[model samples]
Structures are given as structure tokens and as C-alpha cells.
Target: MPATHATEHSITVAAPPAVVYGLIADVAGWPAVFGPTVHVDVLEEADPERGGEQLLRIWATANGRVRAWTSRRVLDPAARTVLFRQTVPAAPVASMGGEWRVESTGDGTSRVVLLHDYRAVDDDPAAEELIARAVDRNSHAELAALKEAAEQGELRDELHFVFSDSETVAGDAGDVYAFLDRADLWPQRLPHVSRLDLTEDEPGVQHMDMDTRSPDGSVHNTTSIRVCFADRGLIVYKQLKVPVAMSGHTGRWEIEPLGDGTVRVTSWHTVTLDPEGVRTALGAEATPAEARALVRKALGTNSSTTLRHARRFAEEARARA
Candidate 1:
């Protein structure tokens, strides 16, 4: 038997076992709670019988770089425990699996334990050490975030929305991601964009500054960061500088091939609205519905325009060929 690299870490959270378990049980929401998790895609749901497998693809930060992998998990809420095994382990990790156990101390506090067992792909100590450090760092951050979220009585509800707009293109889906990937050309390709700058300080991580002209000819300057998942055809982003009527914004762009020679491109947004900003931007008389309408229109028009252009590009290419 090969030697296994194992790690176990726990923290006492000032919350009931159930509260702590609730946060850990829903792995899909990990990105909002864990700092290192940029996005999570739940590929499969667990089967109730025979302890079926629940699969997930997680994009997370390891050693300051984004690393993505798939994991399979089984949950037993009755025992307040969950077991997980990474189906596709990241580099240097031959295999990895762990369990999360939450136990009540009967003193209004609960102990949350995170355990991991793994083996290196090769017996190289230095590579193994790097993997170990990443595991420890991520584990510690997750536990701390879990404690804070559970004790606070909510987990990421403040994020506030999820809205999406999609368009069907009679062209290749793979081509759509390119339109978004080449954002530096947007200013010339799209009229609504006046100025833009993009930088991938590290591959797949993008930082951009853009000035967009809204319908009323008003320009909004925004700074944003995006994590691109090229293989999966998805890009997730958060706006560092937002419009006057929003406190924060996050979004994703996804391209899906319908498999019938057509593709669907979607733009999704989740925003935290500042009611105060509404009054400032739209005057004190604007109602909530009006404010929301304005926000949707302002953002949708720009996104849809981009999607349309992508469609034209794809169709035009096919026509030329």
C-alpha cells in the first residue's frame, strides 16, 4: 500500500450543529462563502438509494492560481456528515477524499471537522509539499468562513439576485466564446463601447476597464474582474466599479451548443441594488419597480448587443466559408 498524505483540521463554531451543517451540506453555494472558490457547477445530484454519487466541478484558488477539478460527494444529514472524493484530482495529487463532520458540544457550540486523505502522483517530496500547503490553506479558509456564516444566521443572502438574458445563434457555440474572449476589440466592434482595456495578469484571470454608453447617451465607466473557464465555455465576473444605481454586480457568460448545429449564448447578472442610489439616479419619485426596470434595460441592452454581434460574426464566418 502506498503511503497516504492525510490532514485533519477542526474549529469550534458558536452555532448549532444543524446551522453549521446547513452551510456545508449545499456544496453549490461554496463560491459565495469561500473566498478561494470562484465558481461551482453541480453536475450530478446524489441518489437516495445505494448511497449514490453527487458530482461537482469547482474552480478554486490554489497557491494563488485558479485550479479546477471535479469531485463526487455523498451526504448524510441524519449523521451531520458528508463524504467527498475528487474524481479528477489536480496535478500532483494521485487521489483525494475527505469527510466533513459537525458535532454538537451540548454547550451552544459545535465542532466542525474537515478531514482529507491523499497520495501524491509521484514520490516527489517538493511537489507533494506544494499540494499539501494548498489543501491546508483552502481547508482553513473554508472552516473559518463556515463558522462566520453560520453564526451570523445567514449564508450569502446579501448577494441579492440572479437574472439572465440569452440569445439563440444559428452558428457554432465555440465561436461565441471567442467574441467574449477578444474583449479588447469590443470598442471597435461594438458602438456602445467607447474605451476599453483588458489584462490577463495571469492566464484565465481577467481585469478590465470599460466605458459603455447607455441608451440615453450616458456613459458608465466600470472596472471588473473575470474568471474565465474556457474549456467549459463559461466566464464569471464581478464589477469592482459599478453604476450609480447599484452597490455591486456579478455575472457570467456561457455558451452552450444545442447539438443541432445551433448555439445559445447567455449573459447572467446578480446585483445588489442600493435604494439610495435609485433616488439619486432616478429622482426621489421613482418607485421600486421603475428602478428595477431601469437597471434591467440598462444592462440588458448592452449584453444583448454583444450577443447579437457574436451571432453575426459566427454566421458571417460560416457564410464566407
Candidate 2:
């Protein structure tokens, strides 16, 4: 057996222990809450909120590299702890496991401790060092984000919103998926996209930078990391650099076949607003409600346009066939 290395990172959050625990337990929301997490898929779970065993597939950034892993977790609500072990660890990681503990510190505050233990393949020193660095960086980032989110309390709703738009395509699901997967052509295909640069360093993992022209003729540049599940017809993306009004943003494009040669394509968005950014971009008098509306319109308009174009492309292909 190889020697294992361990690390622990802790933070004091201005929130109740239960609140912090709840945030940690809700793994599905990690992409929006944690900067390193790009996407999470719940493979198996039984009421994760109440505490139980669950399985998850996660795609995240590790030391600037996109990595995917499957984890088995045991959630203990009574103890305010979550224990997880990666069943299929990524390369250089022979095995990885961790525990998330939330402890009450009184006065409506709590302490969050993230602990990790892992070993490198063959116990190679270089591999071990790399794993250590990644664990340290991700742990700190996740804890700080968790602290900020839990402390928001009632104000959380005002900052975060989830919305989606759907359209029925007259062609096959594959065609619609192809339209989204081939985003490199967006500059030529999508009117609002003035410029786009895309690279898939690793299969199914992409990094993109693009300039989009908004309704007011203003152009905003953004960058994102996308993970594609081709067989499942799902593509999840996280914006690394966002507009002035958004603190965090994640979204998905899903294609579902209707079994009769038609498909339903949807674009889903989850956003966390920056109040001061809202004012900066939309004038100081802009209220939170107004910010939500503005974001919804701007984002929805772009998404609806993509769906329409995808529909047209797919239908045209079918007619040509």
C-alpha cells in the first residue's frame, strides 16, 4: 500500500450550522456556488437533504485542468457531516476521499472543515505534489464560497434565480444537439455572436471566449468552460468571466427526443447576481427586481434565438435528406 497524504481546510461562516450543512448537502447546486465546479450529475440518491447514501458524477477544474470523477457519498444530517470517496478517481489520483463537517460555534455562526486524504498512483512524488496542490486550492475556494452563500440567508433568493426556455424541433434530437455542440461556428451562424474562439483541449471538455452583441448594440466579452455529454444530449457550461451584472452563471442545453422524429430542446440558466454590478451596468437606481428582469430578458432573448436557429438548421437538414 502506498503512503497517503491528507489535508484539512477550515473557515468560520456567519451562519447557523444547519444552514451551512444544508448548503453542503445540496451537491447539485455546487456549480453555481463553487467556482471550480463546472457540473454535477446525481447518479443515485435517496433524499440527500435528509441524509442518506448517494452517488454522483462531477466535472470540475483541478489545477486548471478539467477532470471528471464518480463519487459515493454518505450524508449524515444529524451529525452535520458528509463523507465522500471517489470510486473512479481521475489520473494521477489513485484514491481520494473527504469529509465535510459543519459545527455550531454559537451566535448564529458555524465552522466548516473540509478534509481530504489521497494517494498518488505508485506513490510518485510528483503526482502526489500535484494532487496536494489541487486539493488545497479547491478546498479553500469551496469553503469560502459556501460561507458567502450560507451567510446570505434570506437575501439568497434575491440574488439567485433559475429560468429556462424550450422549443420543439421538427427534426431529430441529434441534429439539434449537433447545432449546440458545434459552437465554433456560432460567429458565422448566430447573429448576436460577433466573435467566438473555442478549443477542446480534452475530448468533451471545451474552453470558449466570445463577444456577443446585445440589443442596445453594446458588445460584451465572456469566457466559459463547457462539458458535453453527447449520448445524453446534455451540455453544461460555466462562465469563468461574466458580465457586470452577474457574479456567477451556469447553464445547460438539453435535447430530448419525442420518439416521432421530433425533439424538445431546452436552455436552462442558473445565475447569482451582483447587486453593485447590477447598479453599475443598469444605473444606480436599479432595484433587485429590476435586475432580475433585466437579466432574464437579456439571457432569455439569446437562448430563444439559439433555439430558433437550431430548429431551423435541423429542419433544413431533414428537408435536404
Candidate 3:
């Protein structure tokens, strides 16, 4: 028999156990809920009440490379726990399994516990510890998020809208593109933008942080990745980091020449909020319009500021040309 090693983590959620269990059972939604660190591909999902199974392929990236594994879920709704076992498709250095349990606390809340165990194929303690550490860190963050979702209700609302604005600027597309690519210019040009940082991992791909002052004078931070397409006069940015209520958000920008002496720029976005999750967190009185306004305000300000800066930068470049 393989040696059993375990690690346990618990979270108290304000939602009922059934609600939390259902969310847990919807394993396919994990990627959308957890963001980029984990990717889950569901091969199969069956009735949880019938004691059926789910087959999933999980891929995790670390140090900029991907590691994949396969696992099977044996669910028991009566017990409010799902047991998972690793299968043959896992990597040579990894074997993983875990149990997800949801229990009602009888005080209008749920207690969730996630227990996982993994042993290296070579039985290396150090390797196991490294994997354990990563898993623990990720699990803690994920569970806490679940608790927040369950207790606070849906973070996102149903109705969503995409708004965009742009302006033409006089300059070489390349010169203008280079300026937009560097996030470090934000604080100097946009008063609403407090701080900006850029991290480049490769040519044409960069991650950016934009810290802005909200209308209420509160600080709001958004992190996104910008991909430049000089050939198309386009620079697209998708939100990879945002406030909780603004989860599942994506945006893009397109810049095109007007065949005259100016570049046409456009920006747009999509956002989704979990209704139940928001209610649990913000109370039943939460309004979707309020959430939508928050996103609109952030995007509107950023887009307008970017356009103004682009125009000024383009004018300067044209003069120097």
C-alpha cells in the first residue's frame, strides 16, 4: 500500500453547506473562479447524487512552464464530501489526491475542509515538500475565496455592459505604440493614476499595474497584460487582476490608421459577477447597477486618460519627425 500523507485546511463560510457543496461540485468552474494559476479541463461530469464520477485534467504552471495531471472524482452528496484519486496520466514526479468536505455548522454557515496528499514517484521528501508548499498556498487562497463567495454572495451581477472611447493622434504608429506599451508613463500623465509598474517577460508581452483613485477618493488597483500588435496598429489589454466583484473581466484595445495623419483607437471590455456570491458578501440589498458602475468608472477613466496621453505623445513625436 502507498503511504498516506495528508494536509488539512478549513474555512468558515456564511452560506449553507449545500450551497458551498454545489459550488465545490462544479469543479469545471474552478478556473474561472480561481484565475490563471490553475487550469481545469473537465473530461466528464456525472450526477453527484447518483454517486457518479468526474474525470478532469488539471494543468498548473510554475516557473513559466506547465505541469499536467489527471484525477478522478468519486462524489458522495449524502456525506457532503468528494474524494479524488490520481490516475496514470500524472507526471513521473507527481501523484495527487484529495477530499473536499462541506459541513453545515447549524448556525447559518458552512465549514469547508480540503485535505490533499501527494507523493513523488521516486518517494523524494524534498520534492514532495516543494509540491506540498505550492499546493498549500494555492489551496488556502482558493478556499478563502470560496468562503468569501459563499458568505458574501455573488461578487458579480447579471447585467453587464462594454464601453469604449478613443482618439486619433498624429505620429508614427511605432512611436505611439512604444509609448503606450510602457505603463510607467501613467502616473506622470494621468492624475487619477497613482502608481504604475510594468513587468516584461517577452517581446510584445508585458504585465502592468495601474493604481487609480476612485471617485470616493479610495485607491483601486487593476493589473492587466498588454499584447502589442504593431503590424495592426493595435494594443490589447485583458484584466488579469481586479477587485472581487469585477471577476471574470476581459478587455481589449484596437488602434488603426485613418489613412490621413492620425491613428484611431478603441477600447472595450466584458464583465461577469456571481449573483449568489455577491448577495452573500454584500447582503441581499446589493445592486447589480452599482457593481456595473464601478467597472464602468474604472475603464472609462483609464481609456480617456490613455487617449489624451496618446494624442499628446503622438503630437510630440510628429513634431520631432
- For TM-score, the strongest prediction is 2
Clashing pairs in 1: none
Clashes of each: 0, 0, 17
Worst 10 residues of 3 by lDDT: 152-161
Worst 10 residues of 1 by lDDT: 152-161
lDDT-sorted candidate list, best first: 2, 1, 3
Question: Candidate 1, which segments miss by more than 4 Å at Cα?
Answer: 1-3, 47-52, 107-109, 152-158, 168-175, 190-250, 256-264, 270-305, 311-321
Candidate 2, residues 213-298, lDDT tens digits: the string is 99899999999999999999999999999999998999999999998879999999999998789999889899888999989999
How far does residue 73 in candidate 3 sit from its true spot (Å)?
1.4
The C-alpha local distance difference test score for the whole of candidate 2 amounts to: 0.93
Residue 220 in model 1: shift from native, Å? 9.4
Q: Largest lDDT belongs to which candidate? A: 2
TM-score winner between candidates 1 and 2: 2
Model 2 earns a TM-score of: 0.97
The RMSD of every model to the true structure, in order and in angstroms, is: 5.3, 1.2, 8.0
Flag the better candidate by lDDT, 1 or 3.
1
